[model samples]
Target chain A: MTGINTPSARHRRRTGRLDWIWFVPFFGFTLLFLVIPTIGLIIGSLTGGHPRVTLKYLAQLSQPQFLDAYRTSIALSAATALGAGLVGILLAWAAIGGGLPKALRPLLMTFSGVASNFAGIPLAFAFTASLGPVGMITVLLQQATGYNLYHHGFSLFNFWGLAITYLYFQIPLMVLLITPALETLGRWSEAAASLGASRWQYWTRVALPILRIPLAGALLVLFGNSFGAYATAYALTSGMINLIPILIGQEMTGNVLFSPGLGDALAVGMVVVMSVVFGLYLLMNRKGGRWAQ
Target chain B: MRPARGSSWLVVLLGAAYFILPLVATLQFSLQTGTRPLFSAYSSILTASGFWASLGLSLFMALAAVAIGLLLIIPAAYWAYLRAPKVRTWVEFLSILPFVVPPIVLVFGMVGLYGNGFGPLSSPMVLILAAYGVISMPYLFRSIDNGLRSVDLRTLTQAALSLGAGWPVILLRIVLPNLRTAILGGAFLVFALIMGEYAISSMLGFNTFGVYMLLTGQTRAHAAAALALISFALVWVFVGFMHAVNRGNITFGPGAR
Candidate 1:
């Protein structure tokens, strides 16, 4: 590829001037629609109904309810991320370690891609329909063994239920993100195994070390993904779940403590948490890229 | 290798079953015929007015959004590839911000921005803009970026210029043709997202398919199941079509008979 370019040609090329006219519409759209609105949200969090600009809204976030919501959000997000990472790593291992038929790889990849995006309300509905009072599984169990899942308080509208629904997407996403890492390891580990290393030794000394950064990075991305999720939780419990995203939505929609300022503060808090997680993901991605080289 | 193969098959079957179980249940619910709840939901949804309207609206919005997104993204991606490679990362990041930020937060921010006289609120246009700008980002950017990376942009430009072709000709005749599949994939993904998107549209008060589903769930359980099944089928069909296209490309090697 480098041979196609000459030194003289490379030197003579100037930094191409951007056609501003071409970008004007897109820039205007993004700036006005996305950037400005976000700025408004930030500012809205600081000021009250009179726009006096006070820290009262941010301070209000310290209340027990808000604090509990934050804690729940963090805990659920962390658990989901960890679950996704472990399942993803194992699935990737199964796929790339010559565990599956080569013909099925593409099929699994496509299935995973679709499933990963298949979350939110539909997923919640599916789970509810399958496990709720009239759910198929609940009905089946009741008929066969005289034991009703819902009659015994087996509702798919609580924290554990939300986490399970989350895994529906989280696991698939992790699989997609980690598969390439596993594939890359396979290429090198095959050679190491050929050099007389046992399977355990090969994984311990070769594959695991190489995959550490990417695996962690993928987990961080999952953490951020689940942390920011709201639609699923909202659909399941209608903002009664008390997750941070649900709390933010409730505040914005005038549910409890319907202060736009407080809502903005919660939004800012969410942004801060996700931004940090995403930053770590970026850092890990950079390191992973370097390691791949 | 042999034992691993057995376990892999087991895992694949289990995974596929897990993914399909909810869909199958929903389908069964949709196809029931009794009032006692065998498949009454499906029949009611099929007979409902809101179901069809919401489905039509979702398809319309998704198509419009995809068209608008392609129009903007193709040029923007091409321009970035040719001129400002250094800022490509920033542009990409900006495009994907909607994905990273929770949909609730994005909707909140959007409502604050456009819910007033400043922009179109409670209108399809705002939803279109959101769809075009936010959901289409990852798909379009990845497609265009991958397409750009696969080709020799400089050589193509130079060849086109040497033959007295303008930038427009090169972009239309050369670059776009090469990036057709990528563009199609991106467009389809955007379509799927828009079709299935519930949070933003529902929050904004537009009765798209997803919103309709939520509403149906509230009012008529059986009808909602039917609607959900219909949506699942539509999305499944689209995903399957894309996969077929991708598989066909793989077999034909991008330029085969």
Candidate 2:
């Protein structure tokens, strides 16, 4: 209570007793479910069917299958995040300052709300219906131009295909997170223009600097989002793609690979990658949020 | 102004195309894919055996998860806002921790820790429910925290305290009722999330709606398209409900990340 919103001494004294009781349920539940489970995975990743620690699973991660899963997943997440970050900033810029109809802002915000949450399986199937082998787009392209999509190495089960699927949510998320940052750009632009700077000069010299942090922060978030995603890609590929999540799934169900310890290591690797990106996001966002507010 | 306006219009339209094209395609596919009559795919899916069971299980779990999640998040977030800045910071970080841990990995950890069928979390339903509450921590916590941010809790609590209302009475009568919109917003968002969740349920061998949709998609493409639209509409309805309850104030849904 001491350093709350108003941090006054009397207010601090009145609430001197730390209200830690209210946090018990939240902490207790998370301790049992989230924290403990994570610790278990870390320990599980180290051991091989025994309580004592070993490095077998750790060594297994160096194999092509596991290495490829980690590499390909990172590549997938980065490509989509970078792609979404660029396009999303453009879209956010257009919405907030485009001088189009004023009505589009709320509409796009609402749409973004729906589209961002509209992920997981249905999204995968929706894309499949639109672009699968016999899908509408594929069929229409074939009929219209005598072009066969699957024949052209454009299968819905491949890496690029999954990137497009992920962009469906990633773009909206980027737009959503970066819009406030974009909204604040106008005040600075007006200031710059009033000071006789050209719009392009203003952007390169002023606006872009301010936006770089938030944009990077947003991209980091998008990377983390897609990096942690398992359901969408799994639903689309049905275990065809050798992503980390798919590998983890295989290990868990004992279908193709049955090493639970390896799965634990994969999970731990995933957590580390995501935590690094997320930690960077927090650091950037703390500085970036200064202007947006 | 004229050039900027034209380019902006183009950009918005292009983005709109990417957003709307799949929806139009899905609707067209759902309508024409099955037996002769329109919406045959939908009708067939409605009559499918596992459809009801999976959908019902997901819905039931959504309610259970929401009930349990709100119970855990609101008080902690509320008190953090009022009296515990350190705890608030810690909870906010924990809330977003779910975002860092993938659903599959979280369940992987859960099974590794408690797969012995000895603890309270052995049952698939219980495990999935707990996993959901954890996965949904980000959205639920964000939504309620947004609500808390909008309220003047200091003045409200102080006034309630001056009126001889105890902590329970204040929390129940004043705080809860005032936060009704926000809590409901968080609940509906959580509802939408759990409805479409796949990995945890499927990994645990639970027949949730998402698992059912994937199965249908493999066997029957047309009915699967129907399920896709139904799934899409459910998300829209629930997210739209969140906005409506908040009177058009969008709460970022799962996009809070």
Candidate 3:
């Protein structure tokens, strides 16, 4: 059956005309919006008012506040990724390990899907409405135990509070990305286990090697996703919390020190952070693609 | 080798409880109707003009953004998949650039470029551009790429060409039908995103659904809760619709891509 169909007869020859017409609108929109805005941001960072090129804006990175913001952002991103990824892997293992009932699989999957995509300001509102001073849970807890979490400094405006809120979405995203990888493991692992292999040995010898690359790649994507996030933190703390995205926003809005050049330089810093993360993601993805093949 | 089922149920229950706790609280707050410090905020927000206008504006913006996104993405994606596969990654990366860039940064950039006498900063059109361009990236790129992966574009083009069908006809008749489910799923996801987006709209001086919640929360806390409830419900519905479409596609196997 395979020998009957050959590539020689039906394949059409290339015209080599290089169809340029189709690319015009696509490239035009990309260049105008994305390329131009980014360039403007970069140039804006390089020069202050009146458009004279200078390096004064770049030197603002030496400021303590900017440095603190950068450190906090990196730390938060790393912690979130690590926590979410580990939990996600565990959840995937449980769900796809034949440990859960058949009927519950779909329900769990749907819930995880919704929760994974569920973040940003609404999530913040949800958490605050439940845990704030006048919040429902807060009121209930106080009435029952004469103890208010808020009075004990459980404010959602702080760094730890923000991290908890961020986890509302991060955990689910990790589960969603990792579940498919688990599903692909199928009955092979079980068959190996039945053949006298211990659980740890089976996973180490078979599954871990196969899944490590994709897991690493997913972790990179999650790290980048949290690192670049702005809305959730912005809405929760009103940009009071010193995060890079918040600082960038403050600078852009002229709320900070009035230096368009400095704001642009801060934006350049943001671009640099995103580029490094994205570069890591691309590298991991390339490795993952090879592994998948 | 079978594990006990009760542990699984416990895990599922714990997960559900964690996910639903905040939502249940929000709903309770939204439903309160008293006038004192705790209760009357919901009723007031429900009767407010700003609430209604913001809701309408948010819906309008979301719909417009989705429509514009579809129009732009369909053609661009089709062209990339069919003619210039080499540039596909770069094009996709560009499309999602706004998303990867901080929202505040993008909003500030927009203000710098178009605010004041230069152009329309506070205009709804600018919000639409930002929302559509940023949020639509994942949807457009994923759906279109999946659709392309599912079919043989070269063979379809050749077959259509031999039968005297033009490029437009082939695209509309042959390509689109296969991509319908993916497009629908993507659109729904984009719609949900725009519905929840707050930073861009709020920063740019527009009153989106999220902004309504923030604004109302300042004075009428319950009203803010009500707004949050409404926003949550809307997003829930959109997510449900996306899941349904995806499930249906999976069942038939036509939309698996």
Candidate 4:
């Protein structure tokens, strides 16, 4: 050990060796649990019950049934992401820059933290109780203003209904993620104002360009978040709808024509879509982060 | 300024209303029993065997997942910060991979790999916990790493080393104590996430709290509402507790004012 005393080799054998060892557990566990499962998914998707690698299932993704599911899910995610982003940015802007009471900020944040994490069946139930058919608000509005929510085709089981339910978490999530970015906007706006730009001009020209990448990133996040959502949609529609997650769940659980391999294909398809969106999000975030510096 | 202030109030009010309305409605619905206000739903859920059993299972799972996450994340994050800076990026990416991979997709992979009806991954508890650990990794890593970021790790490690303390002593006595708030924050988030998690457990055929809620939702409306509110309360408790722990200690960066 003493004879092999080159500086680089010593450094490598001493500190670098132990340092790399620290990563083993994290990477090993991740590889065992996360990476293997993902590889399983990919292999499972490409292969079939025969376990021989084939592109048959990958080709299944383009079928009308599967394509329709993807379409509905994408549409739902896009609507919710866009809706949540606009409203969340508004809410965050109001909370940060709005001339409201100073005490409200912390309260808003605590609530957002709670609400953003508040998902699954309970959240779906909350929305159903409020806006579902025969719900309190639905009944109240019907009796008070002759606005029959159900009769008017506002069922809480369709794409729009699911999108609204998603906003319960999404809007707050948007608020939480976008708030820090919003905090950095103040000095930029003041600088613009000092340059004799009007408020609208400051927003449209200065603020918009600066915030573009981050906002787009946030919306893409919102998109991916909703796109991957399964439980809420499943609980709300009970697999009546053909969303991709529901379809995968249905196939996985053998509720309808169990094909484990096809389920894998659907899952693989979802990962591809989510990965593309997430890649865009990361790209935008990198650009935004660079701009911030 | 006046108009901006007015619109701000309006926006905040409307956002608050959107958030609070469902909760209020659910509470009212849970209290209702055949046209009379009552605690029947609450009592029924409290006495239900499945509810308790599932809730207990979920609690155990959440704890186990948090422990596993802490064991894996704290050391990795600490080491990355101190000596292995290159590993940090990979850890961060893997931790957040759960966000990209839907729960259903992960479950599909699990079923594909381990649905063989034998082995460690065959057990619902082991499989769900492993999956839960992965799902909770992002939150746990983010919170703890954020906390670690607020501490001067290099200086502290060097200080502890120069004081004649070993690595274990430095980590256990010096680093862990300083990271109390971060650990608690991460643990709380992990707990909240595990308790509310539905997709993995439900898909894996486990009777966790979230699964029980979904099952109860189909047949029992008021009971489901009560359980929903209870779940919301559980999350609030965790968030509130974390908020309290992080109240004055919210550091934006190392030595940041």
Candidate 5:
């Protein structure tokens, strides 16, 4: 009787000693740096002041100014994601089927690694000098063709300008993420063709369906990547452009006085948008895994 | 398997042009000062006031971040790999959370929470390093997890335990040596991220290399280009080092000498 225990208790005794010791540092760091601050933001955004709850900040999200910012941010990210996703698939396809020099693949991969991470201020500077009003390309084009790039409506500070600048990093990032998926396509395509499928039929019925999940997943990632970006857009436009991150920066960094609670609301809104995007990403990946197998 | 090579070359050439044009333009811009040598802009950065300081501060911060990130990740990864494999998904989700939660948002929260409670958290150095450590968690965790996956962690631990080896001896002597490549890979990523990180540091008012470059871009365009090229070179070196280490991993498989 002393040695015997109920089955449930014995089962619990065998598996219930949670190995939480190794989690101490991770949980501590996350709680301090990630969780607690986020929680604070949530609380801050919810309450107008101490000991009183208010929806003022959340309600501010409906105002026209905030709406415009959201619109521009979403539009920019969607455009960039679609563009980068399509171009990246092309680049990856070429790397596989383009019959470039053998050394080209590694070289392209290395460059993509650098370019993908090569964002923020320096990237903005490169684009400004390369495409700005008095930039080298502008000056050269003016001298050769006698056409002002700006007069022709190609300013690097406007919406198109930002989109182009975003592509610098976006395309390369897409290439890196999609290359592995593309590499597996050749085998799958061969399998489909061996089964007597025509080229167009193979792509439409078989290849495209298989790639649909990963393609959508990559596009969502690109959207999230651009949506969360701050430094590049901020540097290029100096917060003049109405984007979510820029709007958040302006709200928090007011020259005279700042609104911490309002800023938290904005940050929370950003998290919500990103969460939706990532949720779709997760769903696509899950559905795509079955076909991938 | 090689598809027709026609359109692929067109696409590759177009990409190469788009990628290389700005670099060429930047190089030419950096060399535009008539009196000095073509490398004068680079030389100027070497002699420029506070350039070294900013670069030094960034390096120190990056090093600290890598150390902190490794300290936090290695133990958790090792334990989870050996004991509670079910927790790996949760850990992975947490690790990648930073991507969805942008640095700007996190720093905003930091300002509110710490700026109110802890005065020292407002210090530029402390806040930026903490942010970097958190931001680098995903890469560090993935690499180390991949490394641990390559090795049979449970079997290694059991064998070491059966040999009367202590936990410290097993981890430090046996595990650490086997994980050299992964650690290096993660460290390179951390270094690159820190070197180019601008949003948090700029918002937090830290004088890192990125901050310095941003400030320079405001006034001296050529100098900014020079710094940009220099930053590009540094990133290239890190990528090259990573590639070399990965190539060396040919011998890292099981039973390899």
Candidate 6:
């Protein structure tokens, strides 16, 4: 499997003209379920009570309410991505840099795998149980220090609370991403140290420069992950938060205030945002892949 | 040149506290059902009318998706490994394209392409099951490819061919047994995902476990907490099993290549 990519006739067999037939199931499945639906969504978003394509609903996206949703969604995603990305790098660095006990690395990694997969409604419940009104930590903090979090404007339904909830999975995802990237930087640090570079200097000149691309790439992924997430924010706030996914949900499920194509337009906008973010991620990864190797 | 133990321990401790405290708090919250029988929420949830139905549906969907995904992916991956490398790249990219189109958007597209409620396919379950197969492709392909990397498929196939063994024999008898770990690993990952999935299920008006959890969470806090713990337990069990079976070598979710 490793060396199969080489074009050597001796290494790879290009025989079996009918070999492509096996992939038809996959092609048909993707086309029917994934590709066709996305195309339908884009066309639906463009349709404006005419045979010709129009951007009337797309123009509706500039309305203050819709604009607010996009802003909140993007801000939440960016904040959580940067917040989790920083802390994840810290944890991954600690575990992989040989500063922790040997057993701790695998434990950390296994936990990372678990936590990253741990998202959606259950996560919202967990955070609410921890920090919601009358939650354990809320009650405990008020009892121990008499500091009412809610009185201090720390409601879990607000933007910051949602950010914290998002960080739970986002951080683990960042750890999973940056750990292997961290593993590749040990040699560079050692070389810098051998040149009598101080720890700070080694980090500043050698480690950070090489890591910048992968770090940015990882952050981009974290951003995209948070952006598309609907369940966590929806479950946590229940419409208190005006994020894009929840808004899209309302538009789709709306019976009374149903705008003609607003939901489809919003959905299309989300896909466009995600595409641009991932496109940059691919570019960063291509350049960063060279350094990591 | 030594790693900084003090800072490392500091970061690890802070991180551990942040991660573990929520679970602890969630457990405490689940148990704080005042003036009620001990764990009545859990008991009542078990006896709840829609609980089993929703959970059972999600479970069935997960199993079906895993089976269908394996059937489609194993052959495609094997064929690509033997014959075409370029096609493998295209298929793999398409697998992860679900990432860009969030579940809400995908369902929106489906509604637009098909009818709103019930349309061409007769049942929304069929479309959803197929979508699950497509969405599970990224992890499925990677994991099966990971297994394919470990064994010499070319040599095994050649040896089997020399013995007059057929393709079915080679795939089912030899390849299947050898790739059990990878297959189970990917299956568990998909199982964990589909069981907890909320977006696609809710958008389609399906009464999945995730949708059920949301409804319960809104009405009954105690029961919701109990259900939340159960959901977490389910995920932990499935993911832990995958990790243990793969000996912690398998990674869940896509991360670089």
Local distance difference test, each candidate? 0.70, 0.84, 0.69, 0.82, 0.80, 0.82
- With a 3 Å backbone cut-off (N, CA, C), the pairs that clash in candidate 1 are B32-B39, B41-B222
Candidate 1 achieves a global lDDT of: 0.70
Model 1 misplacement above 4 A? A1-18, A49-52, A151-153, B1-3, B35-40, B119-124, B246-257
Candidate 3 lDDT score at position A220: 73
Residues B1-257 of candidate 2: C-alpha lDDT, one tens digit per residue:
11287788888899998888888888888888434799789888999879999999999989988888888998899988988787899999888888778888889898888887656777777788899889778878877888888888768887776666667988998789888888898889888888988888888999999899988888888888899889888988998888788764454423211
Model 5 chain A lowest lDDT segment of ten: A3-12
What TM-score does chain B of candidate 3 reach?
Answer: 0.82
Those runs of model 4 whose alpha carbons end farther than 4 Å from true positions after fitting are A1-16, A49-51, A291-293, B1-3, B35-37, B247-257
Kindly list the per-residue Cα lDDT of model 1 for residues B1-257, writing each as its tens digit.
11277776666676666677777776665555564666566656767788789888888888877776677667777766766676566667776565555667777877765676763553546644664466566566776677677776767876676566756787789988888777776666666667877766766667888778887777666666666666666766766666665542210000000
Per-candidate TM equals 0.89, 0.93, 0.88, 0.93, 0.92, 0.92
lDDT of 1 by residue, A118-219 (tens): 666676777777766677777878899999876676677877778877887888778878877776775677688678888788878887788899888888
DockQ of every candidate structure: 0.33, 0.56, 0.34, 0.48, 0.41, 0.52
Every prediction: chain A TM-score = 0.87, 0.92, 0.86, 0.92, 0.90, 0.92
Residue pairs in clash, model 4: none
Off by over 4 Å in 2: A1-19, B1-3, B247-257
Error of 6 at B151 (Å): 2.5
Candidate 6: regions farther than 4 A off: A1-15, A255-258, B1-3, B116-122, B247-257
For A1-293, candidate 5 gives per-residue lDDT tens digits of 66346443353355457568678888789788988888888888888446788888888878897888889999999999899898888987898768888899888888877777777888888888789888788899999999998998788987889998888888988887777777778888889878888888888887788788888888988898889888888888876898878877766576324355677888888888988998898899899888666
Error of 5 at B162 (Å): 1.3
Winner of 2 and 6 under TM-score? 2
Best of the candidates, DockQ = 2
Worst 10 residues of 3 chain A by lDDT: A7-16
User: CA RMSD for every model?
Assistant: 5.1, 3.4, 4.9, 4.2, 5.2, 3.9
